[model samples]
Target: MESQPHNDRLWIKLLVLLAYKTATHKHARRLSWSSQTGGVIPISPKLCIKATPFTQLAEANAMRFVAQHTSIPVPMVHCAFEEKGQTYILMERIEGDTLAQVWGQRSDESKARILRQLKGIVEQLRRISAPPSIGVANVDGGPIFDHRLPRKSSWGPFATIQDFHRELRSGIDAGDIEDDASSPGVKDMASFHEQAWQAPVFTHGDLSALNILVRGDEVVGIIDWETAGWYPPYWEYTSAKHTNPRNLWWQEEVDKFIAPMHEALEMEAIRRRFFGDF
Candidate 1:
């Protein structure tokens, strides 16, 4: 007879295989798929699953944190678990077209109304302050996730804004600027970054129109909390500005809701130029 540990391993393998089949089943509707092995699929009318090799527990935690703290509309997470190396998130299936799908056709009045609602939501997010100990972190005080970062994965719960800025500069300290003369801009940018020590606020690190779900002119849901975390005050504005070509129009509208941080934007541009926008 097989040992109990071996049987448990076999059971896990079978469960993962079954989940993979369910994700690829004919009836399942694929929401998004990576070029590699992960994607989101709706197995039933009301139940959706997001499966990815990367750990998604942080995303789930962020969503739950937002739901509890604010009145913002977000999908209800049923459960999150890891199986064989893939993380599966079972959540409510929010039904609506992405804001991107309807934005182009919307009237100026309709767009203004939607932006008003979004501004209110952003204000609510900003109102939530991070505990002093947590500093810059995910909802649960763990390392934050942002694919745009060089690491492209979890990085830090930095004790100070300066520490977080150093990481953003790819470890080039303002003091190190004297030693490394290749990038003179780093010193100025790092100094500017150091001057602003605003307490970290809850940030939806990615505010793309594609992630907002809408019904008519109403925003029914804000999906995709993978990049949500407690970050410096300027983070939301900077991240919103770093939009894709398709989202250029949305980028123009970002400052309508989020207050413009001109200096931080300049610092971000310098950081991107020197370190690359990865």
Candidate 2:
């Protein structure tokens, strides 16, 4: 289940649009009105003059992190600047259609292709040298946000499916998630494999098709890693399944994605710079 931090994020988006433009029907001068890229047309290259402050910083940080470390595909940030009341983030536009919209319109016939592409992207991100972590708050003297616990633990004391499920269930109840959205509350944390899996190399917090760019069966570029976090590798499995063509509430999809990749991820000795369990 997702944290309802920005439970009405889309509504906030709408409100932002309304404030920027008197009418909601038309997008602003810097428009991504539609990011539908057929193989024939490319993704647009334009400055998002009014990109949110949070998003602009995240995009800039992600691009910098990618350039400094890994080569896995992600958009390149041209520059980030703020002027007056508007903040601008310029990025290299990927040349493929967004997987999210495409997947929704496709029948089950396209589902296999979507999953394969998704799997491939997840695999790519998993190969990164460092999982994203700031060690604390972004700015010096800012609020300290520690993901590490007092006891040394890989993936923060929860690596197996049962443990993951329990934590997720706790979140659902604590967050007061609706019944339809909560996980089935695991009966035993020992039922699933007890082996510890590696903490996240870099889990894209938001793995929706909207953040992905696909060309046929390949994921050319994953545009947004704003919500990317450091945690157990299996966390992405839950996230990807939710954004799939058919959103299977924790029951079917999350476990399926992890079962296939668990063996490969667990045996490695993790080396992360300024990375703490999340």
Go through the candidates in order and give each one's C-alpha lDDT. 0.77, 0.43
Residues 45-92 of candidate 2 have per-residue lDDT tens digits of 432222543343443555556555555577666554444544344456
Candidate 1 deviant stretches above 4 angstroms = 1-20, 27-38, 178-184
Question: How badly does each model clash, as a count of residue pairs?
Answer: 0, 3
Off by over 4 Å in 2: 1-26, 29-50, 82-87, 104-117, 131-197, 243-278
* Candidate 2 lDDT trough over 10 residues, lowest sum: 267-276
Top model number, lDDT: 1
